[model samples]
Every structure is written in structure tokens, then in C-alpha cells.
Target: MAPLMRNRSPNNVPNELNVEYYRQRASAGLIISEATAITEQGQGYSNVPGIYTDEAVEGWQNVTRAVHEAGGKIFCQLQHVGRISHKSLQPFGDPPVAPSAIQAKAKSFVVYSDGTSDFIETSLPRHLKPFEISGIIEDYRRAAARTLEAGFDGVEIHAANGYLIDQFLRSSSNQRTDLYGGPLENRARFMFDIVGCISREIGPGRTAIRLSPVAPSNDVHDERPQALYNYIASQLSAYDLAYVHIVEGATGGDRTYQQGPEPFDYAEMRETYYRTDGSGAWMVNNGYDRPLAIEALEKERADLICFGRPFIANPDLVRRLRINAPLNALDQRTLFGGDAKGYTDYPVLGG
Candidate 1:
């Protein structure tokens, strides 16, 4: 929901609308919240929820309580937008931070100070100073702590969708010559370290991460896509995260986006995860439909499936999919920032 711009406090905290929104959709077996900011620098857009404040924690407590009452499991997605931000959205107008100093080719989803949404051209980001990296890792750990305090089943580290983690993981975006760049092993160090830290804070069994092997969004690319992802799966095998959520193709792109890089090992990454001796559940996402999801599970391609857009208008999505019921066409106009008109007003099947 990208925060829904629904805070009455100075901090962008979730309110009752956020609670009721999740409550209404509690039929979902596992609800992964929208990518939430872990720090002010990470709050890349207007009104997204923050986990660093007391008010934010209490607000989330209400949401978790509601979802639990409805018998649904939820995981908070911790995301740091890094360079995909505008000066207006940054902390004290600081230049957005990335692994290196580079301007992304894509535009940012910006909400101006005057409360207007616009696609602004991304600005050049400053290379992260070595001193700042440790603090960012702490940010993830603290945010994961808050996720547990909010009574979530676990936390999903947002290492996908060309965000900060993806920026560091890909060779094109990360030109840092220090320990963070050059070799594939070094490029993935940031993710491994952050994951290790977060997992340490909130038991590895309750810590999870999402990654995209070859997503090109936000001007991200890698010379060895398969190598990077395989390394990721292998390294993560050492830690028993709740799951390794993978976007089967370019994140949120076509379902048949691609079969992987040359040599196209369709299930190589999957095999790599299993090689960990059943380290964690394997999840597949990106443009998945109901039938495809079932087929993938039946074929043992995935342990769980993540459906994105379908849950927008269908609060009773589970029942609808189970019985082949019709779905509501979510009005896109009210998607980004809105009140009850679109957020909490989506009717259930018989409600």
C-alpha cells in the first residue's frame, strides 16, 4: 500500500485504516506487508510506514493484533530504497546513498511536500562512505526487532526489486573497489552480512529474504546473473532463514520473463537451496496466477507462491481462488495515496 499517506503524526505511522485494511484481507495464508522503511534515509517516498518510532510501533501493534484475531500470519518487508529517491524525500535533502556514485536510469515514485505524486527523474546518488555501512546494517537489525515487537510471524528482508540490496548485489550498480565490489563474492558480501545480522537478531528461522536473479528495474544489471543468484542461494544455505523468496523472473515482469542466463539452469538455484539440506522453504513470485501457482507447487518447483495484484481488490482472495469466484477490478486511481474510498472499501464476496 506504500503507506497510503494516512498518518496524522509528524512521523509517517500507520493508523486504523492500515489495521482494517490488513484485517479485511486476513484470509491470506501469509501476508507480506508492503516494503517498510527501517530508517529516515530509507523512507524514500511520502507517507510510507517507519519502524524506528514508538508511535509507529504502537500503530503496527494494532495491525498485528487485528490480523492475528483473524487467524492469518504476516511478515513485515523491510526495504531501504537507497538511491531510488528524490532530494525532497531524503533526510535533510541529502543525496540518496548507494554502493557507488551513480544515477539510476529509471524515475522515482515521488510524493512531493505538497502531497502530489509524480515520476521525477532520479538524481545522482553519493557513494556510501565506509563508516555508514555498519549503521545501515544496524538499521536492518533494529527494524527486524520492531517487526517481532509488532507480533509478526517473521520479517522479509527486501533484497529484491532493484533496491539497495540489489544495487550492491549487481555488478553494474556496484563499482565499489573496496571490500564491497570487484569479485562476485565481494559484491554479495553486503547482502550476506546484512542477512546474518538481521537473522542473528531475530532467529534465522524467523528471518527471510527476497531476491531477483536478473531484474533490470531501476537500471540494475549483472554480467553473471545466474552466478550471483546461485552464490546467494548457496551462501544463504548456511543460515536457516524462514525462506528464500525468489522472483522467478525479472521482478514483477512477465511470467515467462526468461529461463535464467545462458546454460539456463531452470532449477539450479532451487537445487542449490535444497543442497543446504532443506535450509528453508522456497517461494516463487512475479505475475503468478492461481493455476500456475498450483502447477508449480505440484511440480515441486516452489514451496509457496506469492500473488501480487490479485489481492488488491479481493480481500477474500483465498476463497475466491478456491472456488473460481470472480474478482473485483481494483480501480487504479486510488492505489497510491487514498482514504477509505479505495483502501478499506473493497468489498468482500458477501459483505
Candidate 2:
């Protein structure tokens, strides 16, 4: 299962609702939890779960235990929103930190005390200093350690979706003239640093990463995406990662979105990783249905296929796909912050 954010974890801690939610979907081959904040400062959306504090770790323990009891393997997706955040969600209302001071032309989810929540313009951000960059990398390392302590089988780094690591990877978001910017290698430094740290913390065999090479989600852009991602793929070959998940096309939109002069090459990137000795499962996501998924696997286009929205309303999605059963429609209203009305209440094939 792909990581889909449902802002139901009030106070950024998982609860019984989350435990039941994952337990229902335990039939999946592997379940990647929603993008979880590594620290309070890494958060951008309200009511999302975190992995840093003792309380948050304990909350996740219940979740992992339930999933495991049901025979499911789950991974925690560690994330930091960086500039894709509002001051209201930052520590002490400070400006969000990023590779550069520029603000993203995006909105963040925020909930109010009156139980109201809405999307708000992301606040301006200050560029991260050298020391602060190291600190953030350290945060990822600690989060990976906590993930295991919380009973998770593995950790998936949320380096895509215009978050902290994505901000550094794209040229449009990073304009610094320091060691961490300018050249493609320099822009990619931050991502590699985090990958190295997390791999060391929780062994590369349990370390995975998600990337949207050309997706323009969260207003991030690049002059040459093909070159950038191919380079990233080649570098990732050095690590013995568990898997490499790629979001094909634009995030939740076009499956053919292009970002530069040359069209983004998904196959080329995968081949690059393989050619460079990348020993990881290649997981492909975005806009997949039963037939499409079957075709990809039959053609050996992917090692694993991940379905996001279909799994949201179909906890028995694996069984449904096996027998070609119909899927349940998603309740758009309860997709974000809400109670059980649209969550675990979704009916199964014979419920």
C-alpha cells in the first residue's frame, strides 16, 4: 500500500482509529504508513502522525503490533515538509526552513480549535544554514531508529512531493551558491546525506525511498529532471536499499506530465539504477488499476505495484484484485481530518 496522508491523528499521535485502519488493510503485501513527521518542526499538515516523541512512538507501537498480528509488513515514511509549511505549524511560529528563502506557491492543511480545518497559503521560509542542515539530517537518522522501536518493519524516506529533500533536489527551489547547491551534484547532496544517515541507523536492507522525479507537486520544478533523477538513481545504486518507489507522472494528476526540454524517462532511471548495481525492488505507483497493474507486471515493467485511492475505500483491495471484484468509491469529504464515518466504515466485499 502506498502512503496516503489522513490527518486523523490529533496531537500528531496515532490512536486506536489508526490501529484499526491498518489492521483492516493487513492483506496487502506491504503497507507504507502515511507520511509521518520526524519532528514537530518537520510537520506541515495538522493532525498528521509523528515519530519523534515517546508518546508518538507508543502510539505507533499499537499500530504496528496490530498490523503484524494480522500478518502485514509495514514501513514508516519519515518526512519533513520544509518550505511547504505555514508559520502556524512551525515551532514557535517561526518561518519554515528550506534550502533557500523562497516560499512555495502551495497551500498546507491546517485545523482550527473550533474543529474547522482548511488549506492555507504556505508561509515564507528562511534558508537553512550549514549547521542546521546537518541537524535535519540527524533528525532523519533518529527517526529511523525510532521507527524500529515503534515496531515497524522498515522505514521509507519521504524525499519526494516537494518536501524538505525535494526542495533541495530541484533547481527552482534551491538557489544557494554554497556546497549544497548550484550544480546537480551539489543540489543532491542533502538527499544523499539523509539516505546515508538513515541507512546506517536502520540498515539499508530495511531502508527505502520514494521519489517523484518529474512531478510538479507543491510548486517544485527543475531545469533538467531527466539528468537530475538519472544521477540520483545512479547514486542510489551504492546503497542496499529495500526498495525504490517512484511516483510516475504528476502526483495525483497526469500520468504523462513532463517537466523539462526532454520528457522524463522512468525506464531509463530504473535501468540506470540497475546498471549501476542498485539491488532494490523497483516499486511503481500513481494511477494504477487492476488491468494496468497486471500489464506492468506481465511486461516486467515493475517489481511491485502500489495503489493509493483504491486502497483507501477497499481494505480488501488485494482480494478484490485477485478475483476482479468491484471497488468501493471513496468519500472525498472524509479523506482528510475526520472520525470513523468514512474511515474504517468502508465495506468489504462481503462485510
Clashes of each: 0, 0
Model 1, global lDDT? 0.80
**Against the hidden reference, what TM-scores do the models get?**
0.94, 0.98
Where is model 1 more than 4 Å wrong at Cα?
Answer: 1-10, 258-266, 275-279
Model 2 ranges with Cα > 4 A deviation: 275-278
- Highest lDDT: which candidate? 2
Residues 1-351 of candidate 2: C-alpha lDDT, one tens digit per residue? 999999999999999999999999999999999999999999999999999899999999999999999999999999999998999999999999999999999999999999999999999999999999999999999999999999999999998989999999999999989999999999999999999999999999999999999888999999999889999998999899999999999998898889977778788998888634434689999999999999999998899999999999999999999999999998899999989988899999888
Candidate 1 colliding pairs, count? 0
- How much lDDT does candidate 2 score? 0.94
For residue 151, model 2's alpha carbon misses the true position, in angstroms, by: 0.5
